[model samples]
Target: MIRVVAVLALLRLAAITVAALPVQWVALRLGSSLADRLPVWWHRRALATLGVRVTPRGTPSSERPLLITANHASWLDISVIGSLGPVSFVAKSEVATWPVFGLLAKLQRCVFVDRTRRSATGRTAGELGDRLAAGDPMVLFPEGTSSPGDGVLPFRSALLGAARAAILDSGHTRVVVQPMAVVYTRIGGMPIGRADRHRVAWYGDMDLIGHLWGVCIAGGLDVEVVWGEPQIFEATTDRKALAATLETSVRDQLRAVLRP
Candidate 1:
């Protein structure tokens, strides 16, 4: 029965993706607003098909040149966050080479960064800044990598340079850097304990195909997305300090959900 459910869920997701691909392509060519919105619609529908319920707490700021910093736990974070609004992501370059997901990420206008190369950092920051200047709210997982869904890793300060870059490119005196947290709290209608969180998390050397199949078969996932206070990021703002502050905010929010 579980295998049947997983197979059906995968089919539904594939159908949706196939249907949306051409529309997204045309929207991109025409520079239509649909290009920005269709991903959100697709993500919401995808989550529904997977029996994943998202509970968003607090509101995302409406500020322009906005950069949101969030903790990463699973590959599901993309769809989960994209479902909330028209937002792009800052992802590792390897994601751009992924089979189907890479295409989806490109359609969503994600900025891909080659993290292995130190010199690529500035270039990626500029690209992220350009997107932010174009009025796209960009989501960055400053944790640099996904965690085990039990705790947030220390956020790296390198890519926070995008905030400074946004100010320079957009002619904005300051950029709004908002902290966000994504926590998987329940699975199969029961509170998911710390030990069981690995089922939802996709970190380490976990096989993507296996993890995705497990999620589809298990279903009934409940996720909490908490948006923290928005901070004004100026040109002179210390990147290390700002990254630490945002990290603390996300860590606190995650703890509140997982512990309380």
Candidate 2:
């Protein structure tokens, strides 16, 4: 019965993706505002179809040239956050090569960063800065990799350089770096224990197809998204210190939601 439900859910998801792909592509080509909005609708519908409920706390900052720093836990983080508003992501370059998902990411205007090559970091930072300068909200998963939904990995300060870059490029006094957290708290309307986390969190060498199927079969996922106070990043702000502060904010929020 679970397998049947998973199959049905997967078919619905595939249909949604197929239906949106062409419209999003055209919107992007024509530079329409729909390009910024369709993803939100799509994600919300996807979440609904999969029986994932998102509880957003706090508010996303309204400031221009904003960069949101969040902890990574699973692939569903994209949909959970995307459903909130129009925002692009800063993802690893490898994601651009992923089948189907890569195309979807491109449509969402994600900035692909090649983390393996130190030389590419500067270029990617500049691109991110340009996007932020244009008043585009960019979501950065500073943890660099997804965790098991139990803890946050240490955030890398390198990409935080984009904040400084945005300040310079836009001639803005400061850029707002908002800390956000995505926590998977429950499944099937019950609190999730450590052992059940694997069913929701996708990390390490887990196969994407299998994990996705598991999530579809299990369904009834509850995620909490907490937005922390926005920190102003000025020319003199220390990137490493800022990264550490954001990391702490996210970790604290995760603990509050997961343990409370």
lDDT value, candidate 2, whole model? 0.92
Would you list the clashing residue pairs of candidate 2?
none
Scanning candidate 2 in windows of ten residues, the lowest lDDT window is 161-170
- Model 2 per-residue lDDT tens digits across residues 84-186: 9999999999899989999999999999999889999888988888899899999999999999989999999988975577558767878899999999999
Q: Give the Cα lDDT of each candidate.
A: 0.91, 0.92
TM-score of each: 0.98, 0.98
C-alpha lDDT (0 to 100) for residue 33 of candidate 2: 97
lDDT, residue 14, candidate 1? 96
Q: How much does candidate 2 score in TM-score?
A: 0.98
- Please, what are the lDDT tens digits per residue for candidate 1 over residues 133-230? 87889999998899987788999988887557755876877788999999999999999987787889999899999999889977589999999999
Candidate 1 clashing pairs, residues 3+ apart or interchain: none
Model 2 residue 151 CA deviation (Å) reads: 1.1
